[model samples]
Target: MPLSLAYAADFPSFADTVFILPAGTTELPINAAADLPEPVRAYVASQLAADEKLISINQYTHHHYYVVAEAKKTADLTAEALRKAGNKLHALLKTDKIPELFINDLTPDGALALAEGIALSAYQFEGYKTDEKSKKTPDLQLITLVGPQLSTEKVQELDGVLQGVYLARDLVNMPYSHLNATQLANRMQAAGDDAGFQTEILDFVRIEALRMGGLLAVNQGSPEPPTFTIMEYKPEGATNEKPYVLVGKGVVFDTGGLSLKPTPNSMDLMKCDMAGAAVVTGVLTALAKNKVKLHVIGLVPATDNRPGGPALAPSDVITMYSGLTVEVMNTDAEGRLILADALAFAKKYNPELVLDYATLTGSAVRAIGTEGIVYMGTAEEQTMLELKQSGNRTHERLVEFPMWDEYDDHIKSSVADLSNMGKAEAGAISAGKFLERFIEGCPWVHFDIAGPAFLTAPDSYRGKGGTGSAVRLTYDFLKRKATV
Candidate 1:
């Protein structure tokens, strides 16, 4: 269960409480330590050893619960440390399943990080489970922070961002049966309604009428039709004259079309292929909720790449939304195809800048497995630097792949305008090179999140399934733009 967070203005005394202590904190904050029972006081003073540990103590009167969480001091508090501390605290809470946790004496940054760790650590995808008791997770219902500087505004903003992350993760983790293109579009529309944004979903008929050949070519395999989602958020008094466009590749489940992936783990986690779309939806949700003073647009072209009847195959050439042809060298390289259509369509906006996200290439995953996002951009140096800084701040570190002109040679086709698949070497850079063709010289950034979008094993605060990879990174970038 995701932790519900709110600022407790009245600050009621709960039967269960948690004290967050800094590193080497032998004594708790005076207010919290003074109210603690003698045994709990002695235990906190004696046994609260170090950061990244949680100790729970019980009181004799009514068996009240008292827990102490040790987080590294502010000077030592990096994003990784805060996340680790939150994960440690969550691991302890799983055994106790505390309904309400009140954390005392935490800074706003620490509280937000802890909330992220707690919420993400508690994620579980048990949609298919039949047994009610067996399909349970920790019920960490509400978490309240007690600190002098923890303002209601900060708490609300953090709560909104956490909700967005949870939503993105849930969308990415769902099975293809439950979250196909149409269903995903519906979910996007619902999210837009909730966040006061505008959503327009164009179905297959509209897609065909618009001649989105790339999307059509990919959907030729699956019985389920494709969908193109356009979402926009323009708050009153926004500063930007033109919107910032975000495009996402929405291959719901890529079995590689005619060029199929091998059985087992390779194809098993294909449901996470839509993580790019989920992140754009999530970032827009957060931006809208906080009413960031900037106009933003999100475009998602979604479909499942299966090997059913009339599936796309190698040597086939298809025209894209930009009226340029692409040689389908390998059907497995389908993400850029769908994304190409959306990227071309984004040119109509005349945006200040454009960014696209995708779990596009396995080479990216091989390059940096679960460590960071593979990023490349043609935007100004300052913009790119800001993005890298945002990634660092959010702990979604970026590994920059060069956009050298030499990579363009890898995608040149003998007959068609370009080839979907490129040389095996520097495969990730070649894929980015192919995407650059559709940008029409507009300042743009691309994020290949294949490495960090989904995980095979749980890592620290990121759970075993979808990691909600780029939501925080992109959200922070936008926030910086709005404020700076």
Candidate 2:
């Protein structure tokens, strides 16, 4: 079940309570301190004085618990730091099996950040588990923010974003057997239905009629057909005249086509190849749910790249939706192929800005492990700066790489308009250059999210498997745009 979050005017009488305070504070809330025994209060004070970050007082005899989470000093506190602290507290509560809890909203932003962490950390995917008992997740389901600073609107916004993130993670973690191209499109349609967005899914015949050769080439191998999903949210009196376009590569499962990836490490986790699609879907869902007054459109080209019948092969030249021919130098480089079609299709909207996200290259993962995203773009400097700021604020950090003309030269094909794969050097940048061709000089940013999109093990609040990497970052950026 999804975790529930609400703003409480007063603390609950019987539920465990958490005091979220800034570091260097020596005292707890008066009412809370009054409830605790004098000795325990002194112990908490001593712990705070010693700069202990978390102090837990478990009174098993009384079946009550109190936790003091001292966030960073006001001067040192960052959005990311507070979130990390919230993740730690979540772990403690889950281990103790606390069913419900109240957190003192001493600091408004701080409280919200902690709540974001706790809610995100509560996600689990055990849908296929046969044993009902083994499928149980954390009992920390209800979280109430108790303080004057929090508002109903803020809590609702946070809940909407959390729902989007959870949805993204769930879709990413699902195996291709359960989530194929058609199913992925169906899920997006369902999300639009629930979140009040408009969804138009272009079926295989429509895709072929549109002459999306790149997507068609990749889908030739799979028994299932391809789908191009377009989702839009435009409220009355929106902020932008030209809608912001977000495109995601939706290779539901990538076996590298005829180039067949090795099963050991490369192909085993291919279910996450569509993480970019998940992020786009998540962002749209959040924006619609929160009623952000900004016109935004989402484009996703989805299909699995398998080495089955008539799979794409090297030296095969294919035409994209933009009518530009691409020489397939390496079939493993299939992400840019489908994304090329989507970016080209974005031209119909005459978007103010276009941002494409994809697990497009391994060079990106090697350049900067799973710690950050690798991006290069043609967007204006101010736009890029604002995006980077949003990324830092959300902890989905970005590293901008140079998109010089020199990199574009690497993708120039002898036979086609461009080559899908460039020379091994600067593989990530070359992939960006390949997609840049389809954008046709429109302002655009390309994100190579191969690194942070999926994790083999849990990492704090991000958890194991699909991390929902860029969903929060993109949503934050668009949210700021709406406010402006």
Question: How many clashing pairs per prediction, in order?
Answer: 0, 0
Q: What TM-score does candidate 1 reach?
A: 0.94
Q: Which residue pairs show backbone clashes in model 2?
A: none
Q: What TM-score number comes out for model 2?
A: 0.96
lDDT of 1 by residue, 1-484 (tens): 4677887654555456555555555666666655577777777667655432466665533122333333444323454576776787777777676777776654434566666677678767657888887777667888776677787888888788877888899899999999999999999999999998999999999999988999999999999999999999999988889899999889999998999999896999899999999999999999999888999999999999999999998999999989999999999999999999999999999999999999999999889887999999799999999998888888888888899988899999999999998987999899999999999679999999998898888898888888889999899999889886
Please estimate how well model 1 matches the true structure, expressed as its whole-model Cα lDDT.
0.84
Report lDDT (CA) for all predictions: 0.84, 0.88
In model 1, the runs with Cα more than 4 Å from the true position are: 37-39, 48-53, 60-77, 106-109
Per-residue error (Å), model 1, residue 256: 0.5
lDDT of 2 at 11: 80
Q: Quick one: RMSD of model 1?
A: 2.4
- Candidate RMSDs in Å, in order, are 2.4, 1.8
Q: Residues 1-484, candidate 2: write the lDDT tens digits.
A: 7898888888856558777775457777676665678888888878777777777887663223334444444422366776777788888888788888787766545778888888888888766988877778668778888878888888889999988999999999999999999999999999999999999999999999999999999998999999999999999979899999999999999998999899887999999999999999999999999999999999999999988988888899998889899899889999999999999999899999999999989999999999999998999999999989888888898999998988888998899989988897999999998888889779999999999999998898998998899998999999999889
